[model samples]
Target chain A: MEHLLTEDLLCNQLQHSTKQLYRTGMVAQISLAISKPVSQQFACTLRVGEVGVLLAPSGAGKTSLFNAIAGINQASGFLKIGEHDTEQIELATYKRNIAYVTQTPVLFGHLSVGALLDVVSAQQARPFDIKWALEPLKLDTILHMRTLSLSGGQRQRLALLLAMIKGATLLLLDEVLTGQDPSTKLACITVIKTYLKRNQAAALIACHQLEDALALADIAFLQQQRAGIKQWQVMPISNGIHAYQQSLLNDCADTAQDQQTVCASAFLSVLHATTISHDPQLGLCEYRVAGQPCFSAYSPHISAKQSVLLVLRANRVAISKSLLPESSFVNQWQAKIVSIRPVSCQGEHGMLIDVTLVNQGALTTSQQDVVSVWITRLSYNQLHPKIGESWYLISKADAVSLSCLN
Target chain B: MSETDLQAIILTLQLASLTTVCLLLVCVPCAYFLARSRSVVKPFIETIVTLPLVLPPTVMGYYFLVLFSPNDGLGLWLRNVLGIELVFSFSGIWLVSMIYSLPFTFRPLQSAFEQLPKDLHHAAALLGFSPMKQFHLVILPAIKPALFAATTLSFAHTIGEFGAILMIGGNIPGETQVLSLALFDHVESFNSQAAEQLALLMLIFSFVVVFACQWWQTQSSQNGYVVNNHVEGL
Candidate 1:
C-alpha cells in the first residue's frame, strides 16, 4: 500500500497548540508557555549525540529558545547536565560545557584562530585536532591569520571550529550558515553532518532556509504558529520531499475557509494575471501581471503558475482625465479618485492619488484592481481631475511582469 | 659604606621580603573574597583594607606605638604568652610595613580576580573540579600577573616607608634602622656622599623591578595565554 501523505500534517503541525516544559540541560525546569495567549514557546528534547533541526520563519523565537537552553537567558524550566542541577551555576562553568554559535560570527579580535582553539581546549583539558577541524572547514590556509580579517562566512566557519574544539557535549547553532553562499553553505553542512556522526555529539540548529535544514536534519521540528509551540508530528528521512509538500498542502486545506481567505488575501492573493505572447526578443514564458507590475523587479524566485503580487510604484503609472482608448498597452482601467495625498520623491513634490475602479455590481469585486498612481502636483493641477471625476489608467507593456508569490 | 649603613640596607631587604610573603599569605583569601563575595559587609571590609593607604603614617605609627608598648595590655599579654616585644625592634618594623602596604598588595589582586571571566569558574565547576581545586588550577593561574604586580608593589612600597617605621620603632642601629631611616641619618650628619649613593641605589632597584614586571606582562600577553580581550557573541 502507498503511504498516505496528507496535508493535515501541515495544518495540525501549524495550528495545534500545546504547552511543553523542557527541564533538560543544566538548569532546573524551564516552562515554555505554549498556547494562544502567549505562544512564542518552543520545546524539543534530544538525547546525547542526537542531532535536530528547528525550522521556523525569521523572528519566530528560535534564538530565544536556543539561548534559554544554553543557560544564557533565564528560562522557566529544569536543565541538567552531568551532575550539579540548578537554575544557577557559575556562568563560566555552564559555558565551559555548552558552546553557542550565534547568527553573526563572534570571534575574539585579538586572538589568532589557532590561539582561540588552543585556549578553549586548554581550559577544557581536552586535546583538540586543530588542523583536522580547520582543514574540513576550509580554514587551514587562514589558521595563522588574525580573526578580525576574516569575512562573515569565514568567521562563521571559524566559530564552529572553535566550538567543536571546546568539546562541548551539546552545540547550539543559530543560523550558522546564514551568511554563506550556496556552495559554501553546502560544504559547511556536509562537514557538520560528518562531524556529528563521527563524534556522536548532539546539536540543535535553527535555520530560516528550508533546503539547508532539510539536507542536514535527522528529525525536523517546525515552528507552526506564533503563540504556542506544539510538536504536531515528527517525520523520519524515509518520508522524502513529496511527503513534506503534501503535508503542507493538507495543513493549508484544514484551516477554515475564512481563515484561508484572510491568509490568502494578506499573502497569496492573486492581484492580477496576464499572458505574454512568445517573442524571441523578450524570451519564453515572459508575461505581465496585475497590481503594480514590479514583481520581477524585486524578486529572483519568480516561476510559472506560482501566484505573485506586484508592488506598484505610484510614480510609474499615468492617469488621464478621459477614458483611454483600447491600445497595445498591458493594463487600462476606468477609475474614480478615492483619495489624493501629496508625496515627496527625490526632492520633488508629487501627488499620490488612490483610484478605485468599479467592476460588476459590487465594490469588493474590483477593489484589488484599484491602483494608486503618482503624478507631479504641477501636472495634476494642469489636468485638474476632481475627487469625483473619472479617468483611465495606462501602463506600458514592458513595465510589468510575473512576480514571486511571497 | 659604614657598618650602620650596610646593616640598615640588609635589615630593610629582610623586613620587606618577610612582610611581602606574610602579606600574600593573608591577602590571597582577602583579595579573593573582595573580588567574589556578594555579602553586604564586603564594602566595609574593603574600606578597612585600604585605610592604611590613606591614613596619615604618623597617626598610624602613634596608634601602633600605644598598642605595642610594654605597659599596654595587649603588649603585656603578648610578652607573657609569646615572649615577644613589638616596640622599637626589627619585628615592629616588619609589622608596620605589612599593615602600611596592605592596599598595595590587595587592590591589584582583587581587581584582577574581578576581571577574570566568570565563565571560566563555571567551566571549572562543571569539569568536576571542586572549589578549592578550581582556585589552584584555574583562578590562581589566570591572576598570575596581578599577583606578581601586587607582590612587587607591596615590597617596594614597604621598603620606601619612613614616617610610620620611624615613629613606632625609632632608628635603632642593626634593629629598627631601615635604609630610608639610615639615609635620613646620613643627611643629618652632613654625609651628603653616602646619602646620595644610598638614594641612587634605591632608585635603580625600584626602576629595574618595575621594568622587569612590565616586560613580563608584555611577554605573557604575546604568548596568547592571557585572554584580555572579550570573546564576542559568547
Candidate 2:
C-alpha cells in the first residue's frame, strides 16, 4: 500500500512538472513600444518572474502596453510567449494561461465563493481548499455573501485571490489598489509579493503612485510618453534623486533662453546669499549667515539658483520658541506649528515640525499663492513654541535658492 | 382510447424524446463552439443554424420533402445503406422535428456558455486541465440551467410539431401520426366529439407540461441557481 501511494505521488509530481515545462515554454515574450508624432519611443522586453512597475502620467499608454502583451490590443512589435510566436494565438487558448485583473473587478456574481472555487478547481484539476484560500484574502467571512456585497478593497483582493487561485504563471494587474487605504494597500502588497515569491510568477503592475511601486517592486520601469509608447528604463531607487534631477534639467533645456537665464539668476542669488559648513561624511551641506542656520543640501555644491529645484535637507534648519532678532543671514517668517513628528536621520534623533508659514509682508506676487517649509522637531522645541503658536522662521541666503528652477 | 389515438400518443412521446436526446448531443458541442470560438467561420455557421428559425415551416417542409425523395442521392443512399426510406416514415418525422427545434435548443445553451466568465476557463487551463476536461467540468456545470431550459424547449417544441413532420411523415397510424396529427384525423373523419376530446387533452397537456417546466426553472432559480436570462437567438 505504501509503495503504491508513493508511486501515485511520484506520477502526480511528474505530471505537474511536465505541464509546467510546457507552459513555461509556451509563455509569451513581449516587447512594447509607444510612438508619438513627436517621435518619442519607449520599449522593454518582459521576462518571467520579473516585476515590471510602469509609471507615467495619465493616458501614457500604460494600460495599452499591458493590453498588447495580453494580446487584447493590436500592437506593432514582437510578442512571443515561450515558443508560441504568433501576433495573436487562438484567443481562448492564449488567454487560458494569462490572468488579467482589470481596474474594475469583474466577477460572475451568481456563484457562491465556494461553488465558484469548486468549479474552477474542478476545471483546472488541481486540489484546492476554497476555505483556506478565502481565509488569507480575508474573504472567508464573505464566502456566502453576494459578490456585489463586497467593498471595493474586498473585491479587489478577491479578484487577486481568484487570479492566484487560477495559478497562472503571469499576472497582469491594472491599478488593483487604486482606492485602497494605506493599510489595505500594504496588506495587498504583502500578499502579492508572497505569491510572486512562492510561485515564481511574473507580474506587470500599472501604478500611478510611487510609494506603492517602491514598496513591492524588485525592478522598477519608468515610462515616459512622447510621440508613442517608449521602452521602460530600469532605475534603482538609490539613484532616485539624481534621476529626478537629471530629468528636470532635461525639461529645463527645452524652455526659452530668457526664461532659463532668469531661473539661473534666481538660483545663483539664493546660493550666494550665505555660506555655512556642511558635513561631507553625512552628505549634509549647510548654508547659513551670521551663525543662523538656513537651508541645506545633500551635495557640496549647494547653490540657490540652479535651473532646477533642489531637495531641502532637513537638518540645517533650526527652530526657536520666540521670534528671533531680524538678521541679514537667514530668511525669516512667522509660522504656526501644525504637527510635531519624530524622525531619525543617520543615527541622529530628529523631529519633523509641520508649520503653516504666514507670509506677512513679502511684495513679490506669483501665480502660486503660498509656500511651506519643513523643520525638525528639535528646532521647533528649541523655539519652545506650542502647537498653535506662531514662530519666526529663517533661511540662510545661499540656502534660499532660485537657481535650480531653470 | 382508440388504438389509433393510443399509438399516436406513444409515437409522439418517442419522437419528442428521441429528438430531444439527439438535439442535446449535437447542440451541446455546437452551442459551446458557437459561444467560445472566434473563428472567421463563426458568423457563417450561426447564419445557417438560425435559418430554420426564420424560414417558414411550409418552405422548410418543401425542402425536406425534396431532400428526402428517393430520387435524390442522399435519400437513395439512406434507403440502400440503412434499409430505411425517410419519406412518409416516423424517422422522417423525428428528423424534421430535430431541425425545426434546433434553434430552441441551441440558443439557450449558447447564451449560457457565453455568459460564463472567460477567466474561469483561463484559471482551469492554468490549473492544468486539458480542453476536454475543462469543458466537461467547468463549462458544463456552469451552464446547467441553460441546458435544462434547452431540453425543455426542444422537447415541448417536438411534441407540438406539425407542418414539417406532416410533409415528411404523412398520417400513418402507429408509425408517424403524433398526438397533434391524431386530433386532426378525428376532425377530418367527422368525429366531432372525439376531436373535441383530443383537442381538450392536447390543450391541457401542453399547458401542464409548459407550466411544470417553467415552475421547476423558477424554483431552481429561487433556490439560488441563476438561469440564463439573455435574449435567445432566433
Candidate 3:
C-alpha cells in the first residue's frame, strides 16, 4: 500500500497537467544544451503544447540533437523535463516520461510484439486502455507476430505505439515519417495530434520532408545563421509551394495552431493563438483568431489541436459588394477595404486589381495589417468596394489552403 | 599396447581434464578483460597472455622449474606452509600443462567477445541488466561455440604436451608419464612397433576430435538450433 502510494505521488508530482497548473498557466518548455564547444554550441527551447520541426540537410546534427536529449549520446549539459531537472534526480531511480522514437526500429527480435507491449505498458504509471491505444495505428493485428517479421512501415508504427504506450509527455521523433505514404502519414499524425491534445504535451519532429512538413510545425528551426547573432533563420518557401501546401492543409486541416516565435525571410503567414484543434469527421479544424472563434476547411481526418495556416490565394479571392448568400464559395470573411492598387498580370488584356482585405484578427496589431485579395478590374469597377468601407471577402474552399506556418 | 602405456593414456586424460578446467576459470576473465578493456596497458597484458603460444615449451619449462623448484622461495613457502609437494608430481605436470595451453583457450574467447556488436551491450545496459546478468543472459549464449572450441583445443593441447612436462616432471613412470611422454620413450628406445601403435592411437584420437568439432561448426552455421535424435530438412 505504501509503495503504490509513493509511486502515485511521484507520478502526480512529475505530471505537467493539473487543474492548478492549467488555471495558473504552465509552459512545457524544453530547454536543452548540446554538448559542444562554444563555436558549435546549439541550445533551443520549445514551449509546452508546441510542436517544433527541426529542418536541416542530412548530417547537420539533427539526430545528434535528439540523441543528446535522449541520453543516448555522450553529453554533459543541463536537461530539464517539465519541473524535474535530470541533474537533481538519481539516474537509477529517475524515469522520464520522454520517449525518443528513432527512424530505424530498435527491437528484441526474439520477443513477440505483444510481449514487449505488455512490458512497456506495465512500466507506465498510468497505462491507457491497450485496445484503444492500438486501434488508431492498427497495431492490434501485429501483437502476436515477432517484431523481426514486421515490414518497415509496420515496425515504425509498432515502435511509435510502444513509445506512446509509456504515456510519454514529450515525444522526440527523428525522421520517423520521412518516406511513409499518404494514408500512413495521416494515420500517424492523427494519433500524434490526438495524444498531444489529450495530454497537453509537446513534440519535436526532425523530418526530411522539409516543405511538406512545414505545414504541421508551430515553429520551424531551419539552420542557425552564421551571422554575429548566430541565430536560426526562418527562410521562405516559394509562393507556388506555399499556396499549394496551404490548399492541401485546408483540404486536410491537418494540424493545430498556437502562438510561437518565428523570424522572417520567406515564411510570413503566421497567426498568434493560444491553442487550436482540428476535426476530421466534420471536415473542420478550428482555433481562435484574436480571441474570437474562427473556422476554416473541414478535414474529416484531422485531429483536434492541430497547427493550421489559413491561406487565401490571390487569384481565387474576389471582392464583393455585400455578403452573397447564393455564392458557391464556402469561405466568406468581412474586412475593411484598405486600398485598391491597379496591377497587370502576364500582359493580359483584362485589368487586375489588388484589393487589400483586413479582418478582426488583423485589427489587434498597431502595425497596419496587410491581407491582399485579387479581383479583376472590371468586377472591381462595377462593385467599387471603396477604401475604409466594410466589404465581404469571398473565396471557394479550394481557393483557401491551411498554410503550415500559421 | 603395454599395461604401462594404458596407464599412461589414462593419466594423460586425467591431467588434460584438470588443466582444461583450471585454465577455463583463469582465462575466461583474462580474455574478457583483454577483449573489452580500453586501457593503454591492455596490449602489454595481451602479449603476456599469448606469450605461451610463441615461446618454446622448453624455455617456459625452464622458467617454471626455477619458480617452483624445492629450494626456491615459492617452493619453500608451499612446502612449509601448505605441505604441497609439486616437483616431479602430477600437480607439477598439471601446472605446467595449464601454462602451455593458456593461449589455446584464451584466444578464441577473446575473439568471440570482440566480434559482438556494441549495440547489444548498450541495449542491455540501459535495460538495467547487471554485469553478471548480462554474462548469463546475453554474452554467454552468444559465445557458446567459441567456449566449446576453446575447451576442446585446450584439452587436446595438454594431452599432446611433451617438452614442458619432460622438463617439469622428468618422466617418472605412473607419476608424470602421460600419453605423449610415454610414446616419446618408446620412440627413443628400439621399440618401433610400440611407437607406431601409440602414434596411430594419438592420430586417430586427434582426427575424431577435429572431425566432430568441424561437423558441429557446420551445423551451427546452417540453421543454428538443433534437436538431438532428430533428422534435418524434415
Candidate 4:
C-alpha cells in the first residue's frame, strides 16, 4: 500500500500570440497522490493494485497532468515516483518506467507489428509473454502486418499491449477507451485488472465514459474548472458517479444540446449489483442490490452470479407512497429519502431526490445502496416528502441498462 | 579514352562517394537537432546551413581559397602541426564539395525529420530504447526516402562540381581533376570525341540519379512499405 506517485505542480498557463509566447497570468497548481499508502486529508489516494479514473471535461488539463508525470512536459514542484524523488533526481521519461498511451495510438509506423513486438520484448529484463498479453487484445492475427495498416481500434489495442510488455509500474491512459466496442472494451478492462493485480502496479485512466468509470475505478478524481482555474476533488466511486453525472449536465447545457439528453445523463444513478438468475429464453435477468431483488433485460452473454453495473436515468425512476405495487413496473424496492435538491434543465423544473435502500441484515453499512429519483415540481409539492421517510422506488425492468464487469 | 580521362572518372566517383558518405554521417544528426530544437538560435543555425544553397559555388570556393591559403593561420597550423595541406590537393577539393553540397544533403533530411510524427521519439524513449537506438530503428527507417534523395543529390552535385574544384584544386590528373574538369579541358582543346563521350556519360549518370530518386518515392507511396522505402524486403 505504498504511494506510487506524488506531485505538487505549479505551471505557467502559456498562450501563443502571432509574435510571441506569453503567459496568461493564470497558473495551474495541481496536487495529486497516486496509490498513496493512506488517504491524506487533501489528496485522494489510489493505492497499489487499484485503477483510478480521472473525470474531467475537455481542456481541463488531464493530458497536461499526464505529460508532466511522463516527463514530456516541464512542471516544477515536489514530485516522487516510488522511492525516487523525480524532481530532485531528474530522471528521464524512460527511466521513470511509466507508460503513457495517448488518445491516438502512437505506434511505430516504420516497424511491422511483429518487429515492434520483438523490439519491445527485447527491451525488458523479463521478456514479454506474447500469448498471455496479445491474446486478450486480439493482436495475435496482425503480427505480420505493418502498424500503419492497422485500424484505430487495433492500434489502440497494440499500444496497450506494448505498454504492458514494457513492464511499466505506472500507466497513464488518456481517453484510450473512447469509441471502443463493448466486447473489446470489456476485454481491455479485464486485461488491465489482471495486469495490475499480478504486478502490483497502478493506473490513472482518463475517460469520459461514466459506465466504464463505474466498472473500473476503485477510486476516482473529479476535475472542475471555473474562470480558467482547475481543481481536483477525490471521492469514492459512488460520489464520483454523481459528480460525473452533474458534469455531464453542465457540459451538455454549455453546448446547448437538447435538454432531454442532458438531463437524462445528468441524474443517472449507478447501482452495483450481482446477478441472481438470468433467463436467456425470456431475456430477463434478476439482480440483487442492497439485499433487494431487481430485474433488468438480459443479454445472452451475461450469466448468473456475475457482478454487473446498472445505470438508471433519474427521470425513469419514480417514488411510491405505498407498498409493492401491482402495476406494470417490475421493480419496487423499500427505501428512505436521504436528501432532495431542486434542479432546472432549460426551464423544466424538477426535484432530484436521493434515497438509500433499506438493506436486509445480509449487507454492511458501506454496502447500503443509494438511488436517485426525479419527479416534477407538481409531484414534489403534492407529496410533501420529508427526510428519512419510508417510500418505494419503482422502475420498469426495461429502463435499466446493465453491463457485466466480471 | 586516354589514361588521364579514365583517372578523372575514377577520381570523380571516389570524391562523390566519399563526400556523400561523410556528409550523411555528419548531417543526419544535425538535421534531427534542427528539427527538434526550440532554441532561439535554431533559425540562425538553419540559415547558416542553407546559405551555401543560395550562394554561387565559385563564391564558396573563393572563401575556402582564402581560408585554406598556405599563409593563413588555420592553413599554417594544419601544415605545421597536422601536416595536412588544404590547397591544390584532392583533400582540399573534397572538403570544398562537402561544404558546397551541404544543403543538398541536409535540407531534405531536415524536412523529413520535421514531417515525422512528434510522438515517435517520445514513444521509443518510453519503451526503454536509447537515443541511438531510436535514431537507428525509428528515425532512420521512417526517413528512408529523404535519405535516398539526399544521397543521390549529393553524389550528383559532387560529380558535376566545376567552379569550386577549379578554384581550390586546379586540374591535376589523378588528384583533383574530375569528370567535369576533364570534359572542360577536352572542350577547351577541341578534343571533340573525348568531350562528347564525357558529356554523354555525365548526362546518363544524372538521368539515373533523378530516375532512381523518383522511382523510390513512387514505390514507397504505392507499396505502403516504409523501411528502405521499398516492399521487396523486411
Number of the top-ranking candidate, with TM-score as the measure: 4
Interface RMSD of each: 6.4, 4.9, 4.9, 1.9
lDDT of 4 by residue, A1-406 (tens): 2222223321221112211211221111124322222222113333455677877766556777777667776644433333221232157776666778888877777678998889887877774454686777788889999888899888888888888887766777887777679888888888888877666567888987777887677667876543334556667666787867766666655665543344542466878788888887877889988788889887666767777778788888899998665688888988899988776666667888889888853657475557888888899999988899999999899988775344
Higher-scoring candidate on TM-score, 2 or 3: 3
For all predicted structures, in order, the TM-scores are: 0.58, 0.61, 0.62, 0.84
DockQ-derived CAPRI band for the predicted complex in model 4: acceptable
The lDDT of each candidate is: 0.62, 0.60, 0.62, 0.75
State residue B19's C-alpha deviation in candidate 2, in Å.
Answer: 1.1
Best by DockQ: 4
> Model 3: runs farther than 4 Å from truth?
A1-30, A37-52, A73-77, A82-98, A103-170, A179-202, A211-299, A302-406, B1-24, B81-85, B126-136, B172-177, B182-234
lDDT of 1 at A158: 87
Candidate 3 chain A worst ten-residue window by lDDT: A258-267
For model 2, the superposed segments whose C-alpha errors exceed 4 Å read A1-51, A67-100, A122-133, A146-151, A166-171, A197-202, A224-229, A237-406, B35-48, B54-56, B71-73, B111-130, B190-197, B208-234
Ten-residue stretch with the least lDDT total in model 2 chain A:
A261-270
Better of 1 and 3 by DockQ: 1
Could you arrange the candidates by TM-score from highest to lowest?
A: 4, 3, 2, 1
Which residue pairs show collisions in model 4?
A: A35-A46
